[model samples]
Target: MTDRASIIAVLSALAIAAGGAALGTAGQVPQPAGDAPIIIAQATGAQATGPSAANTFNRLMKRPGSEPNIQPSKDGIHDPANPGTALLQWPSEAFAGFPRTNDGNRVDWVKTLAAGLIRPWTELEDPEAEPFLMDLTIVRQVKGSMPNVVYPHLEHTQWLDCTNCHDEIFVPEKGANQISMAGILLGQKCGICHGRVAFPISDCRRCHSQPKTAEELRQLSEKSSWAKQ
Candidate 1:
């Protein structure tokens, strides 16, 4: 009689569990507190519920304007179009009031001031006091259109040591290597320094100071041939 009672109790519990499962399948199950119902919309294929994380982030980050306002710097004031948005000005635009060259190019004030303030090679008593200085004029032009490039060795040596360029980049002997605009553009010879760390190659007149006449070009060619021999 005890075994019979145990079997009956197990059957009754199973029947109750089966009824609960049926109720759950038929949408009759009650949700626990703080639980949200997940309802996927068939039309949009999206959850028809509260704000998404991405939408919340956009609202917090973007200002109340159609266009984005970008400030130049931290200390700069917010743009008028978007009150909260800060914008920054370019270095050229910021210092537009400063002096420029005759051709309306920006003058390198640091280099210009250094040129004037620095001591002359003659004034220095020690041979090593000033860097081993010489000026090289590059006249290897295919056409006699542009001027010769005047390379100031003293200015470069002041900032850099001899080993920085000397047998590695350029041969120490004159006329040992041939430098051309094509090679320079391809990052050879002068291109290694210029347009990288040094002043850009855009300022043609800076190097090409002496514009040679047709006669000068002929004389230069003759001199070059003699040197080769």
Candidate 2:
């Protein structure tokens, strides 16, 4: 009883899904079409010798500091006719003289904040509103040999309010949210900002900073118990 139109639509959907699966299986994503192809720069600033595609998730995940050849046409923004879009400044000029990093736009955001080069407003409406900075550190123990992650509130609070993350991207309560690397890569949880506006998850050591050895954890636990008594 299916009409010809319905059959055609279903086949088209299946074809699209199949194409996506093939791309995922091959671990390759289509690069934006442009005259200049984006390339990942070597540590020595030399061009990587190969036909390897730039802006691949695996490549970015493995290495940081890939200088992309950004262009209006290939910038991923769909809007072209908007007048304000043309006024937007390029990344190189905008981020000039800022502290440098090995990963994510090659700008050290934390150090930049410390150096007072740029003072981001805590709120958009009220420019005078001050940031609510906190010095609390949360150490999350990871499974297996990976080092534990240390989430510093002070650095983040300086740029954002607590409400920015609470009850939306992340649940305020600990152990309530389930986070995974896959989810993060897919632009979920910390990935919301980490990959887009904030620093991309390039180096694992950047987040996995705390060392949670059994002896160290035991000693710390004992000290905490004694202090509580």
Q: Who wins the TM-score comparison?
A: 2
Error of model 1, residue 204, in angstroms = 1.0
Candidate 2 per-residue lDDT, tens place, 1-229, comes to 1244457667976876897688763333344454444444422332558544343334333222223424454366636677777777777777789988776777888898899888778778998888888898988777645678888989888888788898887787778888887888899998898877788887677888987898867766676756578
Q: Give model 2's TM-score versus the native structure.
A: 0.58
lDDT of 1 by residue, 142-208 (tens): 4454786667676676666778888999898867878887888778998887656566676677778
Where model 2 places Cα greater than 4 Å from the true spot, the runs are 1-66, 69-87, 214-229
Model 2 lDDT, full chain set: 0.71
Deviation in Å, model 1, residue 209 alpha carbon: 1.5
Error of 1 at 28 (Å): 49
Q: Candidate 1: misplaced stretches above 4 Å?
A: 1-110, 113-143, 217-229
**Each model's TM-score, in the order given?**
0.42, 0.58
Per-prediction count of colliding residue pairs?
A: 7, 0
Q: Could you tell me which residue pairs clash in candidate 2?
A: none
